[model samples]
Target: MAGARVDPPVHGDPATLGGYELIGRLASGGMGRIYLARSAEGQLVAVKTLLAEGVVSDVERRRFAREVELAQRIDSAFTARVRDADPQAELPWMAIDYIAAPPLSELVRTAGVLPASAVQWLAAGTAEALVTLHGEGIIHRDLKPQNILLPLPGPRVIDFGISHANDLTRTSLTLGTIAFTSPEQARGEPSTEASDVYSLGATLFHLALGRPPYRADSDTLGLLAQVQRGQLDLDGLPKELTALIRPCLAVDPGRRPVPAEMLARFRQSLAGLPVSQGGRRWLPQRWTDLIGAYERHGRDLARGAGIGAGATAEGITVDQRTGMVPPPEPTRVYTQERERAERERAERERAERERAERERAERERAEKERVERERALLAQERLREREWQQELERRKAENKDRERAEEKARERAARARARQHASGPSSASAGAASGTSRPSSRPDPARTPPPAPAPSKASSAVVWLVALAVAALLVLWLATWV
Candidate 1:
């Protein structure tokens, strides 16, 4: 199908195969045409059959039956699960789950190349499918973009474990399968598990660069020679993808990585990315829109088939209808998924612990700063209190010194007055005894005139000078304090 439209059944197409009604032609190849069909229970499925011209040898016919047997053993979510098949029919046919999605080849052709992360996601899913297929000892000789379906949920690997089986019994490779052939396969060496790895690398190279690994030559032989020589055209591949994809294209099969290794490497590359519902986050919106178109096409086909819009193949069982219980392999897909989930949980817990540590450190720093500020304020207050106490003590000492000076001045004044009184009386008596009293310079006691006490006046002036000196000393002391 190109874009969203499936090709209508041509005049030569069969209307029914293995009791399934053919709705539309999904694709056709050297093997045969794959048709969109519905079962009697109104469940959609894809039926693959061999063309009348393809069944030439008995070995080729047996390969179809062998393909059914091997494909049934593989029950992985990454692979298209087989539901029903009939190798005894004139033209053998097998029915698989109908994936309403676009082929990788079509998506890349219409929407251009995918991003490195999207390419890695695609590689992871394809490698997961390879891990399961190789576990069953099935080598998908044709691991190209056309055989991979890109759905919203995840990629599905289709038409696997049949190419190399057919190659062993056939005369040549299918049309256009040589482009993705490994170097050893190109040299006519028997295909191995590593051969599929090489093809997956080529497919990724195409998705990453919009072209195959060795596209220098248009002819098949020239391309085959380049592949054998390991001449890869990897000019623009992202460096992050090199470590994962480059080894797969190694000329030495021994040097190439197995599917499990590839799966691990690709998953590691995508671990830091966010997950989306249905796992569509890795793909671009344009790519998702195209996928939706394909799903709508399936719904449209269902309506034409007279089935309910929500009809699905969930309840229908191939084992019940065909009595074939496909021996279950080890559950690798769910195991890996569980491991991934555990790793993610551990990572989230680590991130939360780091965040909490940072917050605790910040709170401690803030508390330290607050305590330092309070201590600084207390130190300043103590300094001010000590200064105030010292000032009070100095003021008390100055007041006592001023009071002592005033008391000494008062005592000196009183002694001076007493001495002056005694000297005045003695001087008068001496003058009278010597009989040298000049004519009444001193007033007589009998006379009414006021006594002339000049000596007493001088003593009084001395007492006043002493008091003024003490007053001057007190003024100087108070000025010093101010």
Candidate 2:
């Protein structure tokens, strides 16, 4: 492949596209320009924008958006990988990996024509890329040498599915594009997968013979006519390369080999060649040297631009190959979001703590209430015990009082019995004495003087009765005292 055609930024270019810093211009066309830009991570990317010169209409924006969609669908290593895009941007743009290889057009110009083996290798690589592109139902309407880049690994197809829908409408189908235009595209017919095959054949023809299939020095109308008629000069092509490439240049799109078939044919033809052990041995040494120079130049440009030279805040190292820096670990927006989440978590924890504290306090309060209730019960029990003891003491005192009253009554009864017995005996003795005296005074019964002796006896009896009365009174007083 040829060296990259990197140009310095002009006045019309923007400083940045889709947040990528535009360091240089890669290429430009009627619709827009492809800029060599650096990402936030310092990785080099080619950013294509829709703002060419005039006010970008809605139709143009939609077309550019479609281009981004088509480009994104291609996931093969043989194609430029899309990095980022913003179809809704004011100036809609798409970013792709900045391949550090030159186009086959420039390569052929600088290093002269490639040998048969090298050409076959180029054809095989491009055919494989076409297989991938066609598999996605995409036809590279503008497949030309300028769109094919040859890096170390393999050939990379760039600028696929751009603004080809408007190709026929636009009046700026330049000489560079018309040579590779398929007969169907030249005749204003819808270009199909087979159209891409025709274009590939024309492109390979250029690589081999160092000129387009059709002479470009002719007028535009005549060139279009020649392409429409499939009038090509393949006279100077090598005998071995002719059989494989000649069928591709057939006027009928049906006769042209499919990309897969073309890939198989090329691989089979170059099967006897020595295997390229991870180097660009399929290319001449001079071409390989140019590829190295281009790679070194890209590295130097990255260093000079100071792209992704330091570690990210996340401590992830920058990519050494592309000088690509990863996204910042904590952007301002992300930091704010994180802080909000942290605050929420802290609030939740605080609520949980408060709930736990409330539960603990409630338990403590319940425990205290239980203790107080037990104490009150105990106090009531003690008061009941005291009342019972008082009642028992009062009962004991009443029993003693009853017992003393009974004893006093018994003593009083005994005293009264003894007094009665004593009085009876005294009365009986007096009567006996009176009886003896009466017998002696019986002789003088008739006499009046016998009354005097009886008077003494009566007096004695009266005294005895008085004494018994006094004793009975004393006994009553003693019973009262007791």
Candidate 3:
């Protein structure tokens, strides 16, 4: 299911398989149709079955069986754990852990390349998964983003369609995803653990840069030629990750770093970068919310799976609700061998862990001292920040004070200009203004002042002045009448 709803299965598709009710189709590939099935206990599963109507071929059977065996051998937390299978049935079917979070390719195609910190989380988790796969002696021939499911906890590598186990050589199926295919695989050579490393590097490059280093738009022959030559288009790749990823793309398998080494390298690159597996600091809120919803659904489904709900008097409780036969108990011989191997593995792990613990303690002591120094530096930075804030405030206060002063000075200047205009009123009352109009004298700046009346004349001249003024006023009136 890409989102919440599952697409309805095609008409010809079977309604049920091995008693699991097939509700919808998740995907259809060249090999088979993957159906969304529900167990009798209401638990969901992804069931992969072949696409044969009548007689199934022997080669197809072996290929499907090989996939089931390889998938079952892988018991890693970063992979979708195999649940059930029936290889010899009329239509071979294998069921794996049902997931809803979506493939990394889908996420990237929709949301674009992740940020550096998120890429760190992705690289670290994928390396760890590879470590587990290499430890199990399995090489995932196809390790593209499309085969990776991004859960809230981390990425889960799925679809072991082309995976091969080192110890067992099964059907020689010539299948590979071109975008992430290794050079050796392109050259028709046997893929080794290093080939998986190369594919992982390609996948990480795609995650960090939105597309693989090689051009996917090129035709098949050109693309294969590019892969064979180790030519890359690393335009958008982060410089910091170039060292971590470049070695993986080496032409020689022997030169590439092993899974454990790769994991350590990724950890070192992300040492100071804070990361979380459970949809944290690296991922944005919206993506986290979607993951959270899927996580809740997964939890509910796990509770309802019933395989681990309780124990019966005979052995572990089977889903009796489904009439199908449960997987048979392991024989005593196999169980004894498995127990002995587990004990030996545990002893070796315990010894190695003790040695690691001692080195870790020393590192912690040095880290503690370094943290103290950082704390002091952080305090100094805080003081500097406060000083900057204070400086900004002081500048703001000075600007405000200057503005107020300018306003007061402007008021005083305006008052002085008003007083001067009042003093000059008698002189300006002459008709000289009209005489000066020919030269078009510049207008004086206006001020707040009342126009002064014609100044009172001396008594001797008052009569004559009045008569002249009356004549002027009558002449002005005659012009108005005209």
Candidate 4:
């Protein structure tokens, strides 16, 4: 909740802490002051002196002492080993291995991300240190870009001032820079092995993206969001190491690959095996020679193309050409006049071609429009003829029905007369015995045929035909225009 406190630098007279002779101030921070001091045996060491005036409580002093003892126990080559410490002194000071290399941040700022080989070395060394620290049951509460020092052979992890062991929970408040704190630490939760993994992921993100994944106005909120939802954008990352980095940045702590496993994967990736085949593989010995050959080839091509050869001031000519640079010639009045005329002629030709293209496009668009209109007219005419035919068929059906009804009526009357005559003659015989009566003959009736309609729906038909003829004419006209 408080703003970053700017602690004034302690400018006391130079004094020795333990056996190391204090020299001068190297750097200072809220918790302590680092001095460039010499060991009694003449070895240079960086001594971090913690202010004791503020440590009034006995518990705070004991916690500070415990931190010093924990730091002194770590003896890994990948880490800066503490040589000596005097926790009970008026100003507690601890001496650590003074490395002679720039911080990882500085190296990246000056020179870009370490080349593939350098990154591999860094991973191997850092992973080794992490394994050692975690094995000692210590969580390196702060592991970020600035804490990793780049030594000649490899990188060394430093700054274990706020580190604590598995059982120690002295510092209730977050101690490290907010940008690199793991999600758990940022939320004031006790840190674990997974927390260290999260910090490592943040560190790798910086290395890969050339910036922290979470950088907002509020460092605390940004870090929390990164811990919750951040995913490394590895789209353009070199293929060789993306596989190794993706798992390290897994949001789930259990999903994150262990440091040792990551190191092995990194080694396997570098071996140019199936897992590493996607990335480029080049021998260190041949890289420089290949680059030189490429540069020379480029220079020769440039020379052939009548371009200037680029070189450096060290007398190292990238191009094989060796001669005094010549001054450019001035154009003559007649030559200028000829160039001007040629340019004008070319411009005129270009303008004519463009105008012709525009006219052709316009004509084609108009022709297409005409064709579409003709197709629409043809469709409309076909629909009209179908409707007229349906109407005529319905009228014919009605006329045929009337003719059938009239014929049926005439046949029924003739059959009734015949039946009456037969019944009178057979009446006696039919009454005497159960004899069968003579059957009546059926009448032969001719059904009248329906007459044809006086006129066809010539109006609709004629209109349809006219439309078809018109469309055909329009198509013909379009072709002629073309």
Relative to the true structure, candidate 2 has a C-alpha RMSD (angstroms) of 31.2
Scored by lDDT, the top model is 1
lDDT of each: 0.73, 0.72, 0.68, 0.57
Candidate 4 local lDDT, residue 22:
62
Residue-by-residue lDDT tens digits, candidate 1, 84-118: 99988877888988776777877887778898888
List the RMSD of every prediction in angstroms.
24.0, 31.2, 30.7, 26.4
lDDT of 4 by residue, 213-279 (tens): 5532223333355555553344545565566566666666778777888677667655754443211
Candidate 4 clash pair list: none
Q: Is candidate 2 or candidate 4 better by TM-score?
A: 2
Q: How does candidate 3 score on lDDT?
A: 0.68
Q: How many Å off is the CA of 150 in candidate 3?
A: 0.4
Reference-based TM-score, model 3: 0.56
Off by over 4 Å in 1: 1-15, 24-31, 53-61, 166-175, 215-218, 269-279, 305-482
TM-score computed on alpha carbons, candidate 4: 0.51
Q: What is the lDDT of candidate 4?
A: 0.57
Q: What's the count of clashing pairs in each model shown?
A: 0, 4, 0, 0
